[model samples]
Target: MIRYPAYAKVNIFLKITGMRGDYHTLSSRFMRVKNLFDTLWFEPKSTPEFEIRGNFDCDVRSNTIYKAYKHLLAATRSDKLSEWMETHAVCVDKRIPSFAGLGGGSSDAATFLRMCNERLELGLGVEELAEIGANVGADVPFFVYGYESANVTGIGEVVERFDEPLLDFEVVTPQIQISTPAVYRYYREHLYAPIGAEETARLESTPSRTILASMTPTEANDLYGAALGCYRELNEKEGWFFSGSGSSFFRIKDEE
Candidate 1:
């Protein structure tokens, strides 16, 4: 039996530069959690199977672990594994909330890919696993890199691993709600002054080392304004900041 903790993550900084024909161009920094996570258990079986347990309020058929397994099986041509009555049972303890833009789904998918590769001794490289992961979700590749911090871009497929591990941080999610699709749609219609070209230039010019040093909890979430506009609960919160596109918010902690 193999049990792994599926850590949650927060975007330290997020910037939407532009939109492509099929993808959104973004610049962002991410940090992972140590205490909070979804739990996954892979138990040996005679056939390939998946079962999710916990408080997740989402469709099980479209779950990340299932998708990851399907994608991996296709890429590896391990039809034999599939032919078996079952070789493994994936059980997920869903601690992370769904549709909160917490990347719970993506993290689950990444963890599935990693565990399968190790269990089957597929020996797939990081790039190979990430490629499979990208097919599963835009954010799955980050977990594959196994870094505490990373500069992520390219449909969330291309990851530039950071040299330094991120400083200690804490993340807290508010009780409000925001729809990611609604926020983007609203922004497209209103067009509230794109993320200031000057601000982007200044941010891009700052040395990576300095940027990490100067960053604060308040400046942590770039989706603050848009999320707050969508959900009023944020304005009342003192330290909470939005994560990803909406709903959930976070704060950076002082310890590692």
Candidate 2:
């Protein structure tokens, strides 16, 4: 049996630089939060089964954890292992809220991949796992990379690890669900613009904290305007900024 914790993350900075075919190109800073996470338990069994408990309200068959297991089995190209996995029971104790732009689902998938690699003694390295994860979701690669902080780009396949200054913060999740696809669609219609080379250079060179402190309203979240417009009360809140294509907002705690 193996148990693992899937940590939640915050996007300290998000910029939609442009579009690539049907996907949006992004440059952002991601930080893993220490206090928020979900738990997963994998026990070898003779019959395959999966269950999710806690705050998750989604179809079990479609859960990322289950999908990840299938992806791994396919990647290994082992009929025997695939049959064994069909009998293994995996349980998820979900603590991270879904569709809140905190990368909960992606994290769950990434952690599952890691656990399988270790327990099954698959010698796949981080890069290999991350590549497999990218097929699952953009943010999956970042979590698989297992860095506390990173500069993420290129539909989230590019991860440049970096050390982030310690900071305190709070996340507030509204009783709402924002579809990532919907948010991106709205952004395309209302706010799509090319980020100039100079601006991109400045964003790349600046520290995340510095960017947060000096970020213009437009630069904070490209999808913020659309999200705020959809949920008018979000604008009424003070000191909170949208995270990802959020229904959740966050604020940095003041340090004395």
Candidate 3:
């Protein structure tokens, strides 16, 4: 049996660039926080099966971990590999909160892919694993590569690593859960904007610290307006900004 830690991420800066078909394109800076994570345990079994046990409230089969396993299993497509792969069971000890914009689900899926590749000796490299991860979810590739910080763009397919100090931050989730799709739908209907090259370049050139320090209500998240409509208290909080399409908001604080 092997255990893996699937960490949580915070979007330091997120901007909607445009729309690609039905999907929204974005340019964002992502940072992984070490203090928050989900723990997954994988043990070999004679038959392929998945079990999730934790504070999570979701169907076991519907979990991203299981989907990742199935996706990778199909990718191999060898009778021998399939048979060998089927004889495995995964137990997830989830800690990260869902729908909080922490990328908890994506992290779980990506970690499972890496664990399976190593345990099954699939010989898939980081790039191959990231490709498989991307198919599972947009944010999965980020966790698959396991970068501490990255500038992610192109609807999350493009990732560029950069140097940044690990941050100490606080995250708070409201009782209310906001749907990501709902937020995007609201954005498209009410607040869609075409981000020009100049704006994109300015955002890219701005240092992380500068962005964090200057995070006005308007600049924190492009989806803020939609989220505020759904959760009015979000507007009442000081120093808190929505994380992703969020019900959870966070603020960077000084390290003790």
Each prediction's whole-model lDDT (CA): 0.69, 0.79, 0.79
- The alpha-carbon deviation from the true structure for residue 226 of candidate 3, after best TM-score superposition, in angstroms, is 1.1
Q: How big is the positional error of residue 31 in model 1, measured in Å on the Cα after superposition?
A: 1.1
TM-score (C-alpha) between model 1 and the true structure:
0.83
Models 1 onward score TM values of 0.83, 0.91, 0.91
* Model 3 residue 191 CA deviation in Å: 1.1
Provide the global lDDT of candidate 2 against the true structure: 0.79
Tens digits of per-residue lDDT, candidate 1, 1-256, equal 6688887877767777677774566677666766668888765565444555556666667777778878888898886446531655677788777767678889988998887777667889989999999999888999877777777765688787666555545556656556777777655555434455676556654544455456653464445566666666656355545568756666556532
Stretches of model 1 off by over 4 angstroms after superposition: 44-49, 83-87, 192-222, 233-236
Which runs of model 2 end up more than 4 angstroms from their true locations?
44-46, 49-55, 79-84, 216-218
Q: For model 1, what is the error of residue 96's alpha carbon versus the real structure, in angstroms, after optimal superposition?
A: 2.4
Ranking by TM-score: 3, 2, 1
- Extract clashing residue pairs from model 1: 46-86, 47-85, 47-86, 47-87, 48-86, 48-87, 169-253, 170-253
Q: Which structure is stronger by TM-score: 1 or 3?
A: 3
RMSD of 3: 2.2
